[model samples]
Target: MPLFDTHCHLDDPRFADDRAAVIERAIAAGVERMTTIGCADTPDAVGRALDIAKAAPERITATVGVHPHDASKLDDALFAALEAAAHDPLVVAIGETGLDYHYDHSPRPAQQAALRRQIALARAVGKPLVIHTRSAPEDTLAILRDERARDVGGIIHCFSEDAPFAKAALDLGFVSSFSGIATFRSAEAVREAARALPSDAILVETDAPYLAPIPHRGRRNEPAYVEHTAALLARERGEAREAFDAATFANALRVYGLA
Candidate 1:
């Protein structure tokens, strides 16, 4: 079955030396489509994400938005710059932005503001949003509802929330994307969350270079590893691997808005 890694960070410096090889390995492993996220306001990072998409337009695509950790950097000029790049023929979605109260990397207000602005941008540009919410599910849901994120639709990337949160997100027209973390033994609750998700709302990712799953937890992650996550997700749902793979792949396509 064809695989779609709904979220990854192929632009992270970890792959600078052999990004092409990474893509090749992904394709060889049946990952036909992948999205490398760009921050809403980080020009340099987003710029690199675009170039990666441009270099392999057929396989790699990207989304531009300010991540919650760097939300403090957003400004009108920054959004304007990102707006200009919205239709660059590479950005497929509008965010990796939202609340992250856990680290408080960026001020909560800044994160919320950046998220709201990107939600508007996504609506304006008719692109989906890629949300990154963590340890602040209630506030994230509040903001998403306030901004009517359902209008544009998107996925909660690398989701680690509870079943209720997942259900709430699904109720708001959002798809729940599980990452490599779902494959970890300690991630039992997360696996249950994945199982509890409606079939159509379930998608998968590697979030590479970040949450590598079992068998490769301490090592670097890549798109190819998404398959392992997918398999684990399939098992958790009590469905056949091939059937779950096909269903999740379809869900990924729909969330990505791929034609």
Candidate 2:
């Protein structure tokens, strides 16, 4: 079955030495398409993922944003660049932006401010969003609502929350995208959420170079390992692997507006 890795960091330095090989392996392993997230740490680097997507436009798309960790760096110049990049055909979404209170790499206020601005940008550009919420569920949901992000909808990428959270996001037009965390032994809550989510509201990702699934848990992650996370979700939800894969692949295309 073909799979879609809805969220990944193909631009990460870890893949610099063999990025093409990584993409080849992903294709060989059945990942037909992937969205590489662009988290610009500086004003000038905003189009990093778009450059990668340009090379493989048929199979890859990109999202551009200021990650909450780098929220404080999102000055006017960076936001303007993000505004321009959002108009690119290869750029399908407007984030990977949201609250990340867990690390506080950027102050909570700055993160919230950045998130609101990106939501507006997503609405303005007529694209969906790719949200990254960590340890700030209430605030994350609140900002999404306050900013009227439902106008554009989005994906709650790397979902690590519970069933209630998934339902809440779904109510606002955002779907849940699972990562390798779904395959971990200690993530019962995530598994429960996965099982409870409607098939149409689900997606799978590797978050490459970060969360690698079991049997390859300690190794560097790549898009190829998304199959493991999909398999786990299928088993947990009592659906056939082919059916589950097809649903997620289609769902990703739909949310990213490629459908």
TM-score of each: 0.96, 0.99
Using lDDT as the measure, which candidate wins?
2
Off by over 4 Å in 2: none
Provide the overall lDDT of each model, using Cα atoms, as 2-decimal numbers. 0.86, 0.95
Q: What TM value does model 1 have? A: 0.96
Q: Which residue runs of candidate 1 sit more than 4 Å off their true CA positions?
A: none
- lDDT of candidate model 1 versus the reference: 0.86
Q: Please give, for residues 68-93, the per-residue lDDT of candidate 1 as tens digits.
A: 99899987777887888788777888
Clashes of each: 3, 0
The Cα RMSD of model 1 versus the native structure comes to 1.2
Candidate of highest TM-score: 2
On residues 199-239, what C-alpha lDDT tens digit does candidate 2 reach at each position?
A: 99999999999989998999999999999999999999999
